[model samples]
Target: MRPALRTRRACRKLATALMASTVMLAGCASAQPAGTQAPASVSARPSPEATGPVAAVYKDLVYRSIDGTDLHLDLYTSAHANGQPSPVLVYFHGGAWARGQRPESWRGYSRFLQRGYAVITVQYRLAGEAQAPAAVQDARCVLHWIGANADRYGFDVDRIVAHGTSAGGHLALMASYLEAADGLDTPDCEGVPRVAAVLDFYGPTNLAQPYNGAASGRHPSVVRWVGDGPGAHDMDVRMSPLTYVGPDVPPTMIVHGDSDDVVTIDQSRELYAALQRVEVPTDMVIVPGGGHGKFPDAEKARVAGEVDRFLTTIGLP
Candidate 1:
């Protein structure tokens, strides 16, 4: 058997063992109500040891500095490296793009380390700090940072995968699909590397649409991020992932819950249809009774399996 296949099988077995132990997998938090705040638990940072063992862990590494503020990321390399550089899983945490810490759920992502993949969780400006293209720009800068530091970190730049849930998912899509021509790349870290694949978990695709329904009005979080200024609608169009969909975009896997009231499954459906129209390699997994990111243990396990298969199909290292 090929080495990659062997590594995949081993990861699958590890996942099985973790499931049997009733570990709760990491997923996005449900959308906070329009007038509410994210729970304190969601905003709290995880301790360094929470991520478990890895060959190395670099915490709070500054990836970008803008307007007197510095953005950070945490890197966790696999302990199983065999001299070959490892594929990278670049993770963006989700909290309606307003709240949530980068290290919110490191334990849940430890599986990637066990599978010989380097993992990175990023911190970007939130709705309160900056809006719309700001987070998007930071996301692109992260890719550039990875590309610049690949050799030092033993990362395989050719196999970098972007993964995120909810608002983070939107950032992942924007970062992976948008090119230098998009003008979202930061001047300091211009020129993002092509992402190998994208994993979007119930992220909003079209920001122009009213959240939930026309009667529901726009989602407050989105309004906070996009602002209700004179150019709000235009910004909505420019910031939308749907606006940039094209055949050259990386292979993408979308996982959504049919019953999701937060982001609505239709968002993923529309993205899937658009990708299909453009002939991009794409897959969608609709969880029957899943709501937002609150999938049941069984469903989460199934989704993990599907993710593994998708990455394998795309030839991720």
Candidate 2:
């Protein structure tokens, strides 16, 4: 059954906490303060891409957050749910978490389904509706729902790979890193998703950075997610994969367009450095001349192959 979906309300608390982070972003050579930040807006909506043959195979499902906030997702599996377990790839869409949908990111997303991996594209609350952890929480809920339904969906829970592009990448990384952080025995509200690998595509890893600056055109989205003040550093660190680096993290892959204009390639660099620092099995793929949403075929294939290799290495494929 499709879960009833709800756009989350933007809470004053989350907005207030982001004030300091917002200020920090403004000081960047290219960043602006929130007041000076451009008003929230979206690019012209992308034309719908054809879903291809595999889209015909998967089922559509929805799940609610722990708080019962509605979230939607699409699941693409093999011909039969009872077939032997296969590696699973879950994706979150970009749009800065403000105005994108899972289906709109489909040309590349569909390509994954044809690779013999079960794929899921999800829709979480956007910044316009809520903010930071709200989107993260929604993504995590979808993963948890996947784990619970794996038996019926024909995938191994431990063989999953969590991945996302841009803002979605941040959420994906946060979702998995939260699991790693849970090892600290922190509060239960800290959400986590168990996955064998992470694919962060030019994701923002530092919330306190200038990329989220008001002048950067991403300030509103960042502010919506984390809030408007410095105290939100706890949430920032909590969301940052850099904060929980350890050997326990699944083998990881970082793919970024070196020329990405929306989220800087440096974010991927930071994540790569942190992963290397901890001796986590990691691979970094830099696609030259690719800008935001402009990945070439070869680069896209490389991402698929890397995830494929990660799954194969762990006996997940």
Best of the candidates, lDDT: 1
Looking at model 1, which ten-residue stretch has the lowest summed lDDT? 25-34
What's the true lDDT of residue 215 in model 2?
63
Q: Give candidate 2 regions above 4 Å deviation.
A: 1-60, 65-69, 80-82, 104-111, 180-193, 211-220
**RMSD in order of candidates:** 14.0, 11.4
TM-score of 1: 0.82
The list of candidate 1 runs beyond 4 A from truth reads 1-53, 212-217
Task: List per-prediction Cα lDDT, in the order shown.
Answer: 0.75, 0.61
Estimate the lDDT of model 2: 0.61
Q: On residues 145-231, what C-alpha lDDT tens digit does candidate 2 reach at each position?
A: 676666666667767788888888887776776552232211222333477788887888776555434764334656666665554
RMSD of model 2, in Å? 11.4
